[model samples]
Target: MHADQRKKLINELTALIKGGNAHVTLSEALSGIPADMRTTIPDNLPYSIWQLLEHIRIAQKDIVDFSISKDYKTLVWPDDYWPQPTDSVTDEQWADSIEEIERDQQRFFALLSDEGKDLFSPLAWGTGQNIVREAMLIADHNSYHIAEIIVARRLLGIWK
Candidate 1:
C-alpha cells in the first residue's frame, strides 16, 4: 500500500479501536455505571458489566502484547481470557481494569502509528499474522464488546 493510504488506514483503525468513531467508546459506556452496578448481572445477560470490562481489558492486553512479543504463548481459552464472574468487584479493581484498558489501547495505537513498522509484514516469529491483521482484530473485538456494554447499560437504565 502507498504510504498515505497506509497511514490513513492506521488512523482509521486506531479510531475504531479506541471508540473515537461512530460507535460508543468504552469510556463512554462505562462512564455512568454506578459502582454498585458494575458487578450486577442484569437478568438474562451471561456476564455483568464488570465481567465484560475485565474481559475486554484482558483480551486487548493479550493481543497487544502478543503482537510485539517474540516469545508469545497461547493463552488458555475462556479461563485465561475472562475474570471470574461475580457481583463483588471492588471499586479499586474496577478502576484498575479501566486504567489497564486505556493504557494498553495507547500501546496498540503507538504500534500502528510507528511509520517504520511494516503493517503487512508477518511477525518474524509468526506464521501468517501481520500487524495490520492484529490491529483490525483488536478494533473489531473491542467494538463488539463495547456495543455489548452499551446494551447492558441501556438495559439497566444507566446509560446517559
Candidate 2:
C-alpha cells in the first residue's frame, strides 16, 4: 500500500467511525424502544435486529476478504447469509454480532496496512478501484446499516 494513500484511507474511515459513534450517542436511532414491548415487525420483512447485524457483518467481512484475497468470488456471500427471524434476536446475540463487526473492521484495516497499495488494484466492484476506495465503501456501508440497526432495535424495544 502507498503510505500516503493508506493514511488517507485510514483518516477517512476514522472520521466515519467517529461520526457513527456520535450519531449512535446523540440521535433517536434507538430511542423508540418502549419498555414491556415484545418483538413485532412493523412490516412483513423477516429481518430483525440480529439479522441486520449479521447482514452488516457479512457484507463488511466480504469486503475485508476482497481487500486482501486474490479472488473476489470467495468474498461474496450466498442468499442464506441473513439470519431468519431477523427481528427476534436477543440482546446478547445482537451485541455479539456488533462486536464481530468491529473486530472485522480492525482486521480489514490491519490487512490493508500489511498489503499496502499493491493489494489495492481494481477488481470487481469497480473495474479499476483501489483498496482505499474499497475501504471507504466498506466503512460507509457499515455506518449506514448500523444506524438502521440502532433504529430497528429501538423499534423492537431492545435498543436501551
Candidate 3:
C-alpha cells in the first residue's frame, strides 16, 4: 500500500470505529435502566440491549484479529458457540462489560494508521478479501447493531 492509500484507509477505518464507539457509549448509558423497564419487548424476542452489546463486541474482535493476522486462512469460527442472552444480567454487569468492550475497541482502532494498511491487503476467507472490504463489512455490521440498539432502547423505554 502506498503512503497515500494507507492514509486513506486509516482515516476511513478510524471514522467508522469512532462513530461506532460513540453509539456504543450512548447505548450503554440507556442500558442501565431499571430492571422493570426492561421487561417489555417489541416482538417477544428476548434480545436485551446488553446481549446486543456482547454480539457487537464479538464481531468487533473478529475484525481486529483479522487486521493483525497475515494469512487469510487464519479466520475460523469456534464450535458450540452461541450468542448469550444478557437480559437476565444486572445493570452492573452491563456497565462493566461495556467498559471493557470500549477499551478493546479503542485498542483495535489504534491499529488503523499509515503502517496499518497491511490490514487492507487481500485476505483469503474461504473466498477472498482485502482490508477495505473487511472494514466496510465490519462498519456496516456495527451500524446495523447501532440501529438495533437504538430500537431496543426505545422499546425498553430507556432511550433517554
TM-score top scorer: 1
Name the Cα RMSD for model 1: 1.5
lDDT of 3 at 60: 69
Model 2 CA lDDT for position 125: 53
- Model 2 accuracy (lDDT, Cα): 0.61
C-alpha displacement of 93 in model 2, angstroms?
A: 3.6
Each model's backbone clash number: 0, 4, 1
Q: Which residue pairs in candidate 2 collide? A: 1-116, 1-117, 48-86, 48-87
Candidate 3 at residue 157, lDDT?
A: 60
The residue-by-residue lDDT of candidate 3 on 31-129, one tens digit each, is: 466665443445655566656666677766666666556552343454211255433666676667667667656766665553634665565542476
Q: List candidate 2 segments past 4 Å from native.
A: 1-8, 17-22, 25-40, 44-46, 71-78, 86-92, 118-120, 123-126, 157-160
- lDDT of the candidates, in the order given: 0.86, 0.61, 0.62
Clashes of 2: 4
Give the runs in model 1 whose Cα sits over 4 Å from its true position: none
Tens-place lDDT digits, model 1, residues 25-139? 8888888788889888778888889989988998988999989888888889989998887858788888999999889988888888888888899988888899989988888
- What lDDT does candidate 2 reach at residue 58? 82
